[model samples]
Target: IPFSSTTKYQISIHAMEEGYCLLAMKGAPERILARCSTICTESGTQEMNDEMMEICDRACTELAEKGERVLGFADLVLDNQYTKEYPFCAEPPNFPRKNLRFVGFMSLIDPPRPQVPDAVERCRSAGIRVVMVTGDHPVTAKAIAREVGIISYEEVIEAFNINTIETLPPNLPFAKNKAIVIHGAALRDMNDQELDRILYNFREIVFARTSPTQKLHIVEGCQRLGEIVAVTGDGVNDAPALKKADIGIAMGISGSEVSQQSADMILLDDNFASIITGVEEGRRIFDNLKKSIAYTLASNVPEILPFLAFVLLNIPLPLGVMAILCIDLLTDMLPAISLAYERAESDIMLRPPRNPRKDKLVTRKLYFLAYGHIGLIEAMGGFFVYFAIMAEHGFMPMQLFGLRERWDSESVNDLLDHYGQEWTYQNRKELEYTCYTAFMISVVVTQWLDLVVCKTRSNSIFKQGMGNMVLNISLVVETVVACMLSYLPNMSYLKFYPILFRWWCYSLPFALLIFAFDEFRKWRIRKYPQGWYRKETYY
Candidate 1:
C-alpha cells in the first residue's frame, strides 16, 4: 500500500521461516507512533507506556522545529497460525498493525534557495501577500516560512499560542497585520464562512500538514473575496488547486505531468524570483501599449482639420491625400512602434494592481486630451504655417478663403492675388502644393514633442531622459524622411514641394508649447495626488 493523506502510512509484507513479517512500515511520525505498543531497547523489546510515548513525541517535535521532516518506522511479525487464516499477501489492510515494535525516527532537511528571502521581501514591498502551504509538520513549516520572511518570529509566537482556531474569541476581530498558521485537522471542521474570515483577515498565512482538498478550499475561498490568486505547485496532488487559481504556475524541472497540464504558466528554472521578473515585464508591456495608443491618436486632429476647413470654410486644400498617407504610413509608424521598447518607469511595481473593471487602457480622459487638447494645438500650428507660406506668395489668408472653385478650375488661367498680381494656373497650383508640404512639416514637428511627452504618464521627460536608443533612432529617421519628401527633386506626384527654411521654423514655438503644457500637467498631478486635476486631467 502507498502512503496517502488519508492512510498516513505504507505497509508491505515479507516472507519469513515461521510466517510473513510486516517489516519496515513507514509513515507520518504521529500516525505510526500511535499504533506502537512496545519499544526496541538495547536490552530487548520493552512495553511502551504513556510517559515513553510523550518523550518520543517531544523528540519528534524538536527535530521538526529545527526544519527537518520526520518519519517514524515500526515492524510487526505475524505467527504461522494467524498468517494461514488471514493470507497476509492478499489482505495487506487486514494484517495486524497494532502492538508493533517502534524502531526510531528518521529526519531529513531540504533548505530553501538563497534567493527566496529577497524575492519574498520584494513581494511584500509591492503590496503582494505571500502564503506558505506544505504537507510538512507545523513546526517545520513555520520554521521555513519564517526563514523566507513570510511571517516574523514574533508573529508566530503570538498567533500560535492557542492549539486551535476554535479557542479564539468569536467576537474578536481578525487582525490584518498579524500572521496565522492553521493545521489541516482544524480546516476540516471549518465551514465556508469561517474559512472566508481567515482569508480576509491575515496578510500572511501558513497552512501546515494540509491535504490536497484543503488547498483547493483555500483557493476557492480567496476567489470568493474578489482576490486574484496565483498558485505554484510541482506535484500531482497540487493539480486541483493549480487549475482553480487565476494564474497557475508549475515547476518545469520537478513538476509532475498532471500539475504541468493544469498550470497556466511553467517556470523553467523553478525559482520563485523569476515570478517577480515576470510581473515587472507584464507591467512594462501594459504601460508601453498605452503610450503607443496615445501617440497614434494625438495626430488625428491635425490630419482631419485640413479637410474640414476645405469643406466648411471653402478654402484651398492645405494638405493633399498623398501627404496624409505619408504621415500615417511612413513618418509615424516607427516612432509608435518604438514606444514598446521604452523602459519601465520608476514606480511601475510600487503601485497596486489595476482594477480591471474601473481602470481601462482607453478612458474618456485620454480621448479628451488627444483630441481636445494636444491635437487642437497641433492643428493650429499646421494652419499657421500654411497661411504664412500662402501670404508670402502674395495670397493673404482672407483672400484664400472661398477660393476653392477658382483654384481648381482649369479654365481660369489668370487668378488675381491680394496684391493685384496676376498668377497663371500652373503658378497657383505650385503654391497650393507648397502650402500642403508646409502643413505636413508642421504636423511632423509638433509630433516630435508629442512622442517625448507620451513616454511617461506621471514622470517628467527630464527625469525619464531620452535613454531609449530605439526611440531616439526612430525620431532621427522620422525627421530625415520628412525633410527628404519635402526637398527631394521631381516629387510632385506625391504633392511634395520644397518650402522656405523659415516655414519649418514656424512650428517650433507650438512644439515647445506642447512640452511646457504637459510638464505643467504632470507637476500638478504629482503635487496634489488627491486633487481634482489628477482625477480629471492626469491621463
Candidate 2:
C-alpha cells in the first residue's frame, strides 16, 4: 500500500490503516498513523479529524487483540498488555521489489563521466529507465545530457528552438519515450499543484529547483501511481521527501545524520556506483532466499517418502527414529547450508525488476525444480541403498536395517529376532543403536555429496566454481565441522549416523547418476529459445 498528501494539516485515516500496526514518528504521516485511536491528535502542523479518530479506535482494538505492536512515536506503548507485555517497534514492510528515483541536483556535482553513458545504457537494457531532474537552467541541463551521451541531436533537432523555451513551457515531445531532463525554467512558475500535474504524465520525471516540499510532492505523486518509491536526499530541505518516500536512501558520508536517520538504506561510500552495487546485492539476497526455501522444502521429501510407503503397504516401516534423526539433522541441513552459497545465476539482473506487487518468494520455477526433480533424485538414492542391502543380505536386511520401526516399536524387534539370529531383545536394541550410528554417518556423507552435486551441474566438481570465494570457504569449513559432530555417539544424540564403508562406495554411482540428470537438464534448457542460459546470453 502507498499514499501521499500535499498538506500536513489533515490526512484521511483510511491511508493510515493500510497495514502498519506500529507507527514511529519523525514525520506527519507516521504521527497520524500512530495516533489513529486518539480522540484528537496533532504532530507538526497536522491534526486529526473525528472520522479519522473513529477509524483509529477500531484499528487499535483490532491490533490490540491480535497483540500486534506499534511504537517509536513520542511515547512507547504496548498494544496488548496481557498478551504482549514486552514493547516492540513496528517491523518495516517487507516489499518484494523496491523502486527508487535519484533526483540529481545537476550543478551540485561533477559532470557525468563516460561511465555514466554505459551505466545508463545498462540500466535501460535492464529495463530501468533514467530521468535527469535538475534545478539548473534548461540549456545547462540539455548540455549535460548531451555530454553524458543520453541525448542525441536527432532526438532534438526538429524540436522547438532553444531560444523560444521559457519558464513553465508545455510538456516536451519525447516525455513518454527516451530519457528526460526537467530543468528549472520548464516549471519554475509551476506551483506544487501544476508540477504534480505535469509529473503525472511521465512515468518518471526529473526536476531542478525542487524544494523539500516539492520533493515530498514528487514522492506523493509517485505513490499515487502505485510505485514503491524511495527518496534519496542530503540537504535539510530534503527531510520531508526523505521521510515521505516508501524507503529513504541517504548518503552516509556527506549527508546529515538527520537524513541518515530518515533513510532505510544508507550509502556508506556516497557514490552513485554504490547505489547500483546495493541494488545488485539486494537482488542477490532476494534470489538466495528463494534458493533456501527450495532447499528446505526439497529435503523434506526424502525424509517422508519411506514412512508413507511403509504405512500404505502391509510391509514393516523402513525408517527408524535414528534414521529420521539422521535424515533431518545431518542429511538435510548441511546440503542446505551449502546451497546458500549458490552463485547468483547470470540472468538474475538481465530479467526485469520483479513487479512490486509480487511476493518475496518470487522464483516459483526454481522452487518446483528443487522440490520435484532434486527430491526425486535424493529419494532414489535412499531407495537404492535399501535395495542393495535387501539383495545382498536377504530378508534379514529388512528386519535389522529399517531405522524407523527399529527405534519406535518393540514388536518389530521380536520380528527381527524370529529370523534365526542369536540376538535377544537387548542385543537387538544395541544393534538398532549401531544402525543409528551408521545412518548418521551415511547422512553426513550423503549431504556432503549433495552439496558437491549442487555445486556442479554439467561441469566436473573440480571444474566448478564458488563465485564468492570467502563465503565458499566459510561454508566448506562449517560443513566439515558439522560432519565431524554428526559422528559423535551421544553428541550425535539422535543416533543418526551409521557409517558403513562398503555402503559408502555406492554413493559414487548415485552422484554420477545426478551428474547425468543435470547434464540432460542443461542440454534441454540450452536447446530451448526462452531458456535463461540459451546461446549468446550475457553472463
Candidate lDDT (C-alpha), each? 0.86, 0.50
Please tell me which predicted candidate would have the highest lDDT against the true structure: 1
lDDT of 1: 0.86
Q: List CA RMSD, all candidates.
A: 3.0, 20.3
lDDT at residue 403 of model 1 (Cα atoms)? 93
Q: List where candidate 2 sits over 4 angstroms from the true fold.
A: 1-110, 113-122, 149-177, 183-205, 209-213, 253-261, 326-335, 338-348, 362-367, 396-446, 452-464, 467-499, 516-539
Candidate 1, backbone clash total: 0
The Cα error of candidate 1 at residue 69, in Å, is: 2.2
TM agreement with the true structure for every prediction = 0.90, 0.59
Angstrom error at residue 144, model 2:
2.1
Candidate of highest TM-score:
1
lDDT (Cα, tens digit) per residue for candidate 2, span 7-87: 221211111233333322222322334433333233332234566545644654343233223221221122333122233
